[model samples]
Target: MSSTQEFIDEAAKIYKVLSNSTRLKILYYLRHQDSETDVKTMVNDLGLVQPIISKQLGILYRYQLVCRHKEGTRVYYVLDDPHVIEMIDDMLKHVKHEIKGEPHPRTLYDNKK
Candidate 1:
């Protein structure tokens, strides 16, 4: 595979979106839920203001990282892709190993060299 500036810039957008702790929390919450939830539910569950939840959700929605639907007057959200959970899990694992001073397995790029 080749790395291009365009690909790197596009990939950076995803990391930027996930960089916000509140967005990560929202993703984690939705990942564990059996059903989609509205902004009110998220606000209550996260203890955040509705506007804040809505704003973060807007970013997720724009990136298609979350599925959103409107029923009646309320909009509900859920995880759009299961891979996001796996990505988050893998990143957390890497961070945990770094924190513990444990040697990490060779990454894909490392193996490519």
Candidate 2:
């Protein structure tokens, strides 16, 4: 088993990666995509600039949270991290609970033995 400090550090790292809304939206969009997409597609779909999308993608790629493929001069990205998907799902559930005035799963689970 890992130390508590190690777990804390890992959570902090994930939070850092997810702190940007652009990254979150990118991940959300990619989750439903059937094929790997390029920066231009993201820029067009998300209405964000190329540099912003590319920068967020770079961060995700650096953390190995996304898969990158190169075809000739173009690069494509796909959401590749199951843990990131779980985190996103959990966060969305928590937000839904908050909106519905219900207990969050995290809080309930944390209070359990």
Best-fitting candidate, measured by lDDT? 1
Question: What C-alpha lDDT do the candidate models reach, one value each?
Answer: 0.92, 0.88
TM-score of each: 0.84, 0.82
Residues 14-107, candidate 1: write the lDDT tens digits.
Answer: 9999999999999999998899999889998889999999999999999889999999999999999889789999999999999999999987
lDDT tens readout by residue for model 2, 1-113: 56998989988997999988889999989988999999888898999999999999999998888999998988899988867888789888888988999875455668785
User: Candidate 1: which stretches are off by over 4 Å?
Assistant: 1-5, 106-113
Query: How accurate locally is residue 105 in candidate 2, as Cα lDDT from 0 to 100?
Result: 49
List candidate 2 stretches off by more than 4 Å: 1-4, 104-113
Best by TM-score: 1
